[model samples]
Target: MKEKLSRKLAQNVEALKDIFQDSSDLVYRDIQFTESRRGLIVYVEGIINVDLVDQNIISPLIEGLVKAEKPVERLSELPFTRISLTQTSTASDWPGVIEAILTAHVVIFMDDSDEVLTFDVKGGSRRSVQEPSTETVIRGPREGFTESLRINTALLRFKLKTEKLKMKPLIVGKITKTDVVVSYIDGLAKQDLVDSVLDRLKQIDMDGILESGYVEEWIEDNPYSPFPQMQYSERPDTIAAQLLEGKVAIFVDGTPFVLVAPVTLWQLLQSSEDYYERYFVTNFIRWIRLFFLLVALMLPGLYIAVTTYHQDMLPSSLILSIATAREAIPFPAIIEALIMEVSFEALQEAGIRLPKTIGQAVSILGALVIGQAAVQAGIVSAPIVIVVSMTGIASFTLPRFNLATTVRMLRFLIMILAALFGLFGIVVGTVWILVHLTQLKSFGVPYLLGVSPYRLRDFKDIFVRVPMWKMSQRPNSSSETNRNRIGAPKLRGRADEHEGW
Candidate 1:
C-alpha cells in the first residue's frame, strides 16, 4: 500500500508541477527508514509557526520517547505536546495530504506508512490594537477595532462581557475566503432581521471582499441610490449600543469600520458622545447640527435663486450690498456659485489626500489663494465666496460623511433647479427629496422615523436629546424584545412621614 501510494503521489506531482511552479515556499521532503526512524514534513514556509512545529510536533516524533520501530504508531502520539489541536486527519493519498497541508496545518509523512498525520499549525502576522483615528472622542475609551477578525470580535466581547453577545462567522468571497462576523445580543435582536441579514449575505458570490465597504455595496437594498442604507462606525460603543437596540452589526476581517444595519437618516446625524453629555448641552448641539444640515444642502441654491431671479425677495439694503459686490464680476450668479462650490470641494479633497504635515497648510493656503485670486480677477463675486465658505463649514457639522456627501451632491442639483425656476423650483426639489426619504427604509424601518411617521415615543431622542431619566425605552423601530430600559422612579419618603416631620 505504501509503495503504491508513493507512486501515485509521484504521478500527481508530475502533473501538478506547473501549478506549484512559482510557489517558492512549497516543500517536499523524502526520507528513508533507519534505526533513528526518518519521515518528511511538508508545509508552506511563513504561514506556519516554525518554532512551535519544530519544538512540539517534529522534535518529539523524531528524537523523543515516542520514536517507534513502526512509523504509523509514532505519528499518532505526536499531538500530545501541541496545545492547539482542534482536529486531526489521517490521509491515505498525496492529494488528500496536500489538501490538509494547505488548509493552514502541517503535514507529516513517514516511510513505510500509508497514513499521514496533519498538525494544526496556523500562525501569521497581524496588527495590534490602537486608538481609532477617525472616531476619536476626548471623553470616551481610546481602544479601536483592528483589521483582524478575531481582534475585532475580542474588542466587542471586552465591552459587552456577556454570554448573550453572539458572533456568527461567515465566509463571503469565493477566492479570498474572507471571514465576516455578524454580532448581536441573542435575545435582544429581532429574529426575522437576523435571518434577513444572513439570507442577503449567503446570496453574495464574489471573487474577493477586500473591505467592509465591499460587503456594504453587495448587500445593500438599492445599489443605485446615493444614500447608504447601512451605517459604518469604528467605535465599539456605537456598535454595542446598536446591538442592544436590536440591530445587527457586521464586522469585516480587515477593516476598522464595522457595519450596523437598519439605521435611520436621523440616527446618522447623532454621535455616541451625545448621550454621554448633559441633556441641555447635547440638545443644543443636536439643534445646531439639524440647522446646519439644511444650510449645507440649501445655502448655495438659495443664494443663486435670490441673486438671479428673486432679487425682489431680499430687503432693499441687502440687495444693494450684494449688487455692489457683484458689480465687478463677469459671470452670472449660477456660474459663480458653481465655480466656488467646486473649488471648495477640490480643496477639501486635497486636504484629505495630502499628508498630515502638509494637509492643513495646503487647505488654508489653497482656500486663501483661490478666494482672493477669484475675487481680484472679477471671475466670482465676494459675496458668493462668503456663501460657499459658510456652506462648507456647515457641511462639516454633520457627523456622518455618507450623509454629508449626499447633501453636498444634492446641493448642486438644487442649484440648477433654482437657476431655472427661482425659489419655487427649490421648494419643488425639497418636496421631491422629502418624498423619497419618506419611502426609504433601513432594513424594514423608515428612514425618517420620528418626524415623517410621527412616532411621538421616539422623539425623546430625536430633535432634542432628552435627559437619561426620561428615556425609559429603546427606539420602537429597533423592535427589541426587552423594550423597557428603565423602571419608574420611586418617591424617597412617604407623605405621612413628611407631615410628621
Candidate 2:
C-alpha cells in the first residue's frame, strides 16, 4: 500500500509542478540515494523557515549517516532525532506533498516506504502584538491581537486561563483556506446558540473569506439591512466580557478585528471604557452618547422638515433669523443641505486617504474655504451650514465606523421621506427602522433586547451602566444559564464585632 501510494504521489507531482510553474518562490528538490532510492521535498521559499528545517531535518539527515547507502536504516536507528519518523509502504504522492508544503511543514520521502515524514516547521515573519490604535483605553492593558492565528489565540488563553474556554477551529474559503476560530465559555454559554453559530458557519461556501467582515456578511440574518448585525472590536477585554456573557466570538486569521455575535443596537453605542469609569459618570456619558446618536441620524432630516413643511414648528424670532439667512441663497433648502453634507463627506474621505502629515491641514482648509465661499456667494444659507456642521460633529461621537456610515446613509433616506410627507414621513421612517430592528436577530438573540422586550435583569448594563459591584450577573439575553458573575456580600456591624470580643 505504501509503495502504491508513493507511485501515485509521484504521478501527481507532475501535475503540481505544472500548477506552480510560474511561481519563482516554490522550491522543489528530487533526491536520489546511493542505493538508488527516490524522493522529493517541495515548499514555498520565504513562507517556510529555512534555518529550522536545516538544523532539525536537512542537516542531520543529508549530511550525517542518512547520506550513506543505507540511509533509511540509519534514520530508523538514530535516537537523537526529535521528529516522529514514519515509514510509508506506498509511493510518495503529489496532492499530499502539496498540502503539507503549503502548511509550512517539511515532508520527507524514502524509497521502498509508503509513509511520508512530516516535520512541523511553521516559524516565519509575523507582526508583534501591539496596542490597538482605533480602540485605545487609558486604564486597561495596552496589548492588542496580532494578525497571527497562534498569537491571537494565545492572547485569549492568557485572559481566560481556564479549560472551560473553548476554541473551535474552522476552515473557511475554498481557495484561501482561511482559518477561523469560534470562542466561547462552555458552561456559561447556551448550547443551542453555539450549535446555531457552528451550523451557520458550516453553511458558508464562498471562494474566499479574508476577514471577519466577510463571515459577518455571509452569515447575517439580514444582509440587505444597513445596520451591522455583528459587532467588531480589537480589544480583548471587550471580547472577554462578551464571551463571559455567552456571546460567541469569531476570530479570523490575518485581521485584527474579532466579530461578536448577538449584538444589540445599544451595544454599538457603548465603549469598553464605560465599565472602567464610575457608575454615575458612565450613566451620564451613556445618555450623552444616545443623544448624539439621535442627532447624528435625524438632525438633517428634522431640519429639512422644519424648513420646508413645518415652518410653524420654529419660534417667531428663530423663523425670522432663518428667513434672513435663506433670503440671499440661490438654492432650495433640500439642495443646500445636500450640498453641504456631500461636501463634508468629500472632505472627510480626502482627509482619510491623504498622507497623515498633510491630511489634517487639508481637511481643515477645505472646510474653511468651502464654508466661506458658499456664504459669500449665497449658494447655501448660513443656518443650513451650521446644522450640517453640528450633524458632522455628532456623527463622530459613534465609536464604530461601520455604524457611523449606517447612520449617514440612513439620514439621507429619512431626509427624502421628510421632504415628501413632512413630520409624518419622519415618524413613518422611524417606525420602519424600529420594526426592522425588532425583527432582526444577531445569532439567535433579539437585537433590541433590554429596550424593546424590556428585560429588567439585563437593564443594569445596557442604556445606563451600573457600577461593577452592582452588576452581579451577565447579560440575560446573551446566556440562558450561569448568569451570576459575583457573590452577595454579608454586612458586619461594629456592635456584632464588640459582642464577639
Candidate 3:
C-alpha cells in the first residue's frame, strides 16, 4: 500500500519525485529560514500562474516565517493570509499531494510536519471570450463560452442569477481527470431526468476523454442512430434559454461547446434569433426553413423519380428542355445525379477542411469551373448541376450541423431508392424515415415529441412560434410542472414582463 507523507521534508520530497518520475516541468523550490528550519514548494512549471505563486504564496510565506518570534506549526499561527482561507487546504496522504500538484495547486512541505499546505494558484494560457464562430446572430449577446470551465459557468450565472440555478460538478476520465458540470434549475428540471443523466454519465468508465464528443458518444441512448440526441451550443444565451425550458446542460472542460439534452426535431429547426425577432417575421422565416428542409432531403430523389419513370407528369416544354440538356449525356439520370451530388459534397468538405482565407473562394470557383466543364464535356447535364446546387444550398439552411449532416447522408439513400423504384421508391424511403423518427428517443423523450405524439399544449411553438405571451407553458417533455413563464400569460403583462410584442 502507498504511504502517507512523512515528517521529514527530505523524505517527502524524494517520494513525490519518485511518483512524478521523468517530469521535467515539476518545480521544487527549497526555502531555508534557519539551520534546522526548511521548506519546499512544489508545482508544475507551466500550468500555474508563476507570478501569483511568487507574489502571493512564496513571498508571503517566507516573510511570515522569518519574522515569526517562534516556530509556527499550524496555518493560523502564520501572520500572512493573503490567500483566501477557502482556497487553502491541508492534506497528508500521497494521493492527495499528487492530485493537488497535478491540478495546478501549490504545495508547501515543512521540515518536521506530516501535513502539507496547498494553495489554489491554477492558471495557464487560455483563449479569451470571443463571438462563437459556429453559431452567429445579428441581435444577441456577442460573447461566447471560452475553453475555461469556470468562465463558461460564470457566463451562465451572469444570465441566470437565481438561487435555484445549480451546477453539479463531476470528474470523468481516470487518466485525463476531465471536469464535467451538469447545470440545471433545480425545481424546473424533472427529478427523474436529472437522475437518468447522472446515471449515464457516472457509468462512463473511459480512461481518457479528450473532448465533449467522447462523453456524448458514451452517454447517448443509441450508438447506431445518426441523429444527434443532444444539441451543442457555443453561445451562453442558447444554453441559458435551454436551461430555462428545464433541460440539462453538460459542460466538459477544455471545450466551448456545451451539450443540452432531450432535444426534439422542432428544437433542431429553431434558431437562437427566433425569440429575439418579431413573431410574424420569425414565423415567415421558420416556414421558409421548413420548406427548404424538405428540399434538402427530397429534392434530388424527386428529380430522379420524375424524369426516369414519371416523365408524363411534367409539362411538354419543361420535359423537352430537360431532354435537350441531357441528350448529349451518356449516363442515365441516377448516375448523373450521383456524380454531381458526390462532387458537391466533396467540395463542401474540402472547403471546411481548408484554410479560411482560400476555402470560400475554392468552393465557389471549383463548383463553377467543374460544373461548366462537365456540362461542356457532356459528362453531366446542366439540369442535374442546377438540381445538385439547389439541394446543397437548401442543406446549408439547417440551423444545426448534426441535423444537416443527417439530412445529407439520408439524401444519398433516398436517391438510390428513387433510381430503382422511381416515385414509389421515394415514397418508401420517406415512410421509413418518418417511422424511424417517430420511434427515436432522446433521453426518453420522443424525437418528434410535439408532432408525432401531438401534444396540443406544446403546439404553440412547433410549426409556428406563437407570440411570447401565448407560449406561457413550457413543453411537457422538458417541464410538466411549474410551466408558467409569465403569470396568466393571456391576461396581459405589466411593464417588467416585456410582453409588448
Candidate 4:
C-alpha cells in the first residue's frame, strides 16, 4: 500500500513535516505566486545547489514570468531553461517524494493539485581530479578518478569516445542507495563476462555500501583466498586500458578506486609504466621485477634453510664469515630472521599511517638504527639483517599493494617450513602454491591465465614485451573475437616517411 499526496498544500506540508520529524536540516519554503495560488518548495539544505533552485525554479514562480489559464496549470507553466537536469515529471506518491528529497532532488507542492513536480539537483563539494598516489607512473595521464560516480564515468567517457562504451548503472545499498556503474566495451568484452559480473552485483543486498571493498568482498569468487581476485586503481587511464583489453570495471560511489576483473598474477606485477615506455626499457624492468619478486618471497627462508641444513653449499670464505657473525648471537637462524621480519613489517605499517613529511625519514632511520643496534648487541646476525632489508626493498618493487602483502605473509610460512624440513620444506611450499594458483579462478577465468594454459600470444606481453609494431593483436586476456587491434605492424619506417601529416 502507498500513500498518495493530497491536493491541499497545507495538508501536504503537514504530511511532509510528519514524515521528516525532528530533522532540522530539512527545509520547507512557502511560495505565493498570486492571491489564490500557493506552493511549497522542499529540499535538504547544503546538498543541493541553492542558487540554481532559487534562480531557476523559485524565481520564475514568484515573479510574473510564468503564465497559466488556471491555478492547477500555473505550477506546470514555468518559463525557464533547465540546466543539468533530467526529465521533469509530476510525482503523486509520498514514497517518490521522499526518495527525491533524499537524493538531492527538489520537490514542489501546489495548492488544488493532485501531484507535485520534482527536479534533479544532485550537487555537493567533492575532491577534484589529481595524480594517483597508489599507482604512480613516470609517464601517463595525471588525472585520476574522483569520489563522484558521474564524474568518474565522465572521465572514462573522455578517454574512450564511443557509443559502444556502455556504463550500466546499479543501486547497491537499500538505505544508502549508493550508485555503481559497470563499464565495458560492447564488442571487445565477452557478453558472458558482463552478465556474470552483473548477476553478482544484483545479488548483493545490504543496508549500506561505504566503499568498493564492500562490493568486492561480496562478489569475489574466492573470499578466503589471500590474493585479490580483482585489481583496483584510481587512475582513469588504467581503467581505460583495462576496458580496451576487454575487462569490466566496477565504479562505486564515494570511492575513487575502480576495480577491474579477471586479473592474473602477471597483471598485478606489471606496472602502467610498462606500456608507456619503450619495449626494451619495459622488458628489462619487468625482468628485474620478476627477479626481485622471487627474492622477496624466498630470500630469508633460503638463508635459514642453507645455514641450518646445508652450509657446505656456500663458498668457504662466506660460510666462515657468516659463522663468525652468528657465534655471539643468542637466537637461531630462523628466530633471527623472524624478529627482523616482524620489526620491518611494523615499521612499514607505521610509516604509512604517519604524516608524509617525516614518514619516509622515520622508516629509513628507524630501520638503520634498529638493525645496527640489534647487530651490535648480538640479538641477530648481520647476514639476516641484510637479507631482510633486501626482501623489504624487493616487496616495494611490486606494483600492487595487495599482492605485496600476500608475498609478505607467505614469506613467514615459508620460513617456518624451512625451519622444520630445510630446503625440502621450501620446495614443498612452492609446489603447493603452484597447485593452488592453477586451481584459483577469477570469475571463471584462471588466476594464472596465460602461464598455466601456455598461450603463445600472451607471451608477447607476459615474460618479455615485444615491440608495439609486432603487437598488432590483443593479448589472451580478452575474447577470441576481434582479437586483432591494428591492421598492420612494421618494424621500421622508411626514410621518406619523415614528412609531416
- Give the top-scoring candidate (TM-score): 3
Better of 2 and 3 by lDDT: 3
Score each candidate by Cα lDDT.
Answer: 0.81, 0.79, 0.89, 0.88
Give the lDDT ranking, best first.
3, 4, 1, 2
Question: Candidate 4 lDDT, tens digit per residue, 1-501?
Answer: 338988888888888888899999898898765578788889999778888888777776555434644444556665444434565667899988888899888988889886888888767677888888898888988888989888899999999999999999998999999889999998888888999999999999999999999999999999999888999999988899899988999999999999999888888988888999999899999999999999999999999999999999999999999999999998889999999999999999989999999998999999999999999998998999999999999999999999999999999999999999999999999999889899999988888877888887776788898877777777676777878987766657576787675
With candidate 3 superimposed using the best TM-score fit, by how many Å does residue 77's alpha carbon deviate from the native?
3.4
For candidate 2, lDDT tens digit of each residue in 221-337? Answer: 889989999999888888997888888889998898999887888888888888888778888988888899899888988998998998998999999999999998888778898
Candidate 3 Cα misplacement greater than 4 A, ranges: 74-76, 490-501
Q: Could you tell me the lDDT of residue 77 within candidate 3?
A: 64
The window of 10 residues in a row where model 2 has the poorest summed lDDT is: 83-92
Assess every candidate by TM-score: 0.88, 0.90, 0.96, 0.95
- Candidate 3 is scored at a TM of 0.96
1-501: candidate 3 lDDT, tens digit per residue: 256888888888788888888999999899875567788889999888899888887787778777878877654565566654358888989989988998889998887888888888878898999999999888888999989898899999999999999999999999999989999998888988899889999999989987899989998888788888999999999999999998999999999999998899899999999999999989998999999999999999999999999999999999999999989999999999999999999999999999999999999999999999999999999999999999999999899999999999999999999999999999999999998889989899999988789998678888898889888778887656687787743565467677676
Better candidate by lDDT, 2 or 4? 4
Off by over 4 Å in 1: 1-19, 25-74, 82-104, 107-122, 487-501
Shift in Å, residue 156, candidate 3: 0.4
